[model samples]
Target chain A: MAGRATPWLIGLTLVLMAAGLVGGLWLAPPDYQMGDGFRIIYIHVPSALLSMVVFAVMAVASAVGLIWRIRMAHAVTAAAAPIGAAFTFIALVTGALWGKPMWGTYWVWDARLTSELILLFLYFGYLALVHAFPDRRTGDQAGAILAIVGAVDLPIIHFSVQWWTTLHQGATLKLSGTPMPVSMLWPLLVMMLAFLCYFAWLLMVRLRAEILRREYRARWVEKI
Target chain B: MDSWHEFWTMGGYARFVWPAYGVAFVVLLGSGWAAHRGLRRALARVASRVRGGRR
Candidate 1:
């Protein structure tokens, strides 16, 4: 890739990822009721959180791409598509898995799950729209419009469970409360940090490749 | 690893938990592979373009 990610950033991301994994796997206390099955929370919650974060990021980048006519911004939004889709898919699958054991069913059209599912569809639709266009700039512009429009669903997804009687559990970890016991909270936090690092690493790698792809004619790309 | 065994056992809730982890595992692995492939392909394309221009 023409764009080089700093070694320091990559190293720091790995360190955070390692800490998160260790904290999540060993340090966190099992749930009083669900026991280790609750361990899945480490991955599930982070994945869900990141999925939303990625969408918001793509939306913002799309806006930047549209407003400033920046090819790099368009590249970022494009690179984000599949990664966001993957994270959303993980969240949905893991949620369903967790739900089955706890809720005694494989699937439920609960508000939170349903809204999250819609988010996934939005990602897919955006991808489809981007690819459907013959002109690259037109594709980026159209996709950007869709991304901005689809962002309306994000708030609904975040607050869906609270706003509706859903099978999904309410947020256990919040800024205000003491949080689940230190043991559980530590791992959960670690996992969240790790997931964020992982996303950074992925995004950088993806963005670097994208920059090279879209800016092949650029001078710096010739050397790197 | 015995961890796999422990995972599937799930303390008698084997079916529900295993599938969840299994799917997550598959998705992560698949995405990792896809990302690697994408990076490599993009690098190759850029490399060739750079080389072709020089020639």
Candidate 2:
């Protein structure tokens, strides 16, 4: 169903990403304090946000699959797992790079960092459970349960900075307002949107391939 | 030329800044390529199965 639209989505994602990079790396002014090092925020923040957003998406898809007994929903959970993991990985590495210059250490055993690491592990665990079972249905069920359980970490990751005295700074962008100047904020916002588009594009492509694999024996698939 | 050098230097934090972006670029691109390859492989397998069944 989404085959024709996939190419268009990829094109749109690329354009937005290019605009975001230009806005972030070139147009945005250097921070008064951190100077150009703050530019990493353009990549780091969007990646960190997507890390959690993708997990929430996977958890919701897994829940729906469990409730509705929909194979396609399970396929979506499968498709989203590795992408979420990749974002989580990027967030960690970029955060570390930012940390070393700002925090003077590569890592700290802080609440936010630890919780984000756990989120990566959660993704790995889900992927493992999905493949562990002999029957695909059983694998889906097992993976779904693990995904639902792991969602408890999302709030923990979000609130960690607030609840603990971590080296990591408090939220840069909040519901009320961000302290960032308009020049910097706009690029960050654009980059966030670009990353989101990239995520959606990947999810759609992976979901199509997953659905095809799962339904290869069905009449509709044969028609394709 | 001076301004270009400053841009690349990233105010002396270039070591940390460039690698962060580089890794993000590589990981995202690698995953996208892998996904596309997976789709092609699935299509090939399905086509073959259908053809074999006909025979």
Candidate 3:
């Protein structure tokens, strides 16, 4: 791995993330109803979206590792557990905050909220399984299998609100709708992009660390 | 309440709104710090092992 490439990738992510945060937090318009507090949506929506994206990435990486015996893939899947868990935490927190104002309660047992809670549990379960085995390789393989099995629950998480009775609001920033005012939309989009960049940047750093740990005997690990 | 409008503005809801934000801020900072620390520890362990392997 070229030393230059990693730095460049990280640098690009930082630049994109900064631009996105500024656009979302400062430039975007407050919601007509929620006012200034609606700004949390920038953080909230991205976290929700990334929670799904990160898990999907982990599952796919684990599959690759199992099928092709690519240790790099296993490392990637293992590295993502905590990051995805963090995103899920953000989503749940922001949701509760927003709900306090809008729904008149700090927490609710609605279908959407419950399902999101389950997603967080799933992430924790995968992490726990990884550490359960006495052998590290056994842990990795077991965790990978768990990731694949857990992926089946993702679709349920996504559609739970639509199918069941829930207090959570439906999606607002769809591609087809007349977009929210430019003020609001700009900031939301910027925040979403910022979060995506941040996720990628963090994932790469974690994966690199995992690579080093697993291949510590190799010359590359020594140089790093 | 000063006025109904002010109350809806969370002049009264300040307790709820501020705590939500506070909780979120704490969670974000804590997680980021944890991840950074974990990675650093992993790197250090790897570096140590590499040195031992060389010996």
Candidate 4:
């Protein structure tokens, strides 16, 4: 079963995390502009990237749930909401930490910042909505609409730095080999992989929990 | 000790840097544990009900 793979996946996550943390913290060179403080990018970038990635997961699942009336699809959206929220929180705080030294303020009315904050609140709203009704399916319907609507913020968050004069920097690792050097790039790629692995482990665990909750009395529960 | 202190300092952004990683680590691990524990409890509940129903 999928959940059986979780322990191994989590083990992989831990091992990769230790290596990536070392690579990110000590091996990666300081940025020319930000000095050693720029090491925060290792965590910040992955969290920020995952925040968007998780939302995309939530929105897609919600869409499929609504379209197909699939209970499992809704379960995925529900499971992903809080995970996505945590990632958004990490992104926000780390962004502020990096911002204070670089932009001279912990926050601003920057379009990117505002859109990302809205993303956090969207996750919160979706989560709250998912449990509001006595019938899980009803709540799932409501959350699906919100997740789809809130998805508009994703493109806004991605392009905010480009679309407006924002303090936030644009994407660092474009495919063109344009911006960052190889030394800085490897840790980033590793950290991103680590984040995905961690998310996968967590998601599998959450999915089984959701299944058990939804199907606790079913005979299949005893077999597992 | 001196090199350790320097590493901990994070080039003087220790306050911001450490908390960021700390929060992420805590939340990630905490949530994973919660899911694992939740599953165990739910399964136990189902098992108990199954046994009781059989009797």
Q: Which candidate has the top score in TM-score?
A: 2
- Show where candidate 2 strays beyond 4 Å: none
lDDT of 2 by residue, A179-216 (tens): 99998998888889889888988998899889899988
CA displacement after TM-score superposition, residue B39 of candidate 4 (Å): 1.6
Ranking by lDDT: 2, 4, 1, 3
lDDT of each: 0.80, 0.91, 0.77, 0.87
DockQ of each: 0.46, 0.70, 0.32, 0.57
Candidate 1's displacement at residue A76, Å, is 0.9
How would the docking of model 2 be graded? Answer: medium
lDDT for position B13 in model 3: 44
Error of 1 at A29 (Å): 3.0
Proportion of the native interface contacts kept in model 4: 0.53
- Between candidates 1 and 2, the TM-score winner: 2
Please compute and give the TM-score of the first chain of candidate 2 against the native first chain: 0.97
DockQ winner, 1 or 2: 2
Which regions of candidate 4 fall more than 4 Å away from where they truly are?
none
Q: Between 1 and 3, whose TM-score is larger?
A: 1
Clashing pairs in 3: A24-A187, A29-A183
**Tens digits of per-residue lDDT for model 4 on A1-224?**
67678878888888888888888887777788887778889899999999999999999998999999999999898888888998899889988988988888999999999999999999999989888999988899999999999999999999999999988988877777758887788888888889999888778878888888898878888787
Residue clash pairs of candidate 2: none
Over A141-174, each residue of candidate 3 has an lDDT whose tens digit, in order, gives 9999989988887887777778887788777576
Interface Cα RMSD per model, in Å? 3.1, 1.7, 4.3, 2.1
Give the candidates in order of TM-score, highest first: 2, 4, 1, 3
Q: What fraction of the true interface does each of the listed models get right, in terms of native contacts kept?
A: 0.51, 0.74, 0.40, 0.53
- Report the alpha-carbon TM-score of model 3 versus the true structure: 0.84
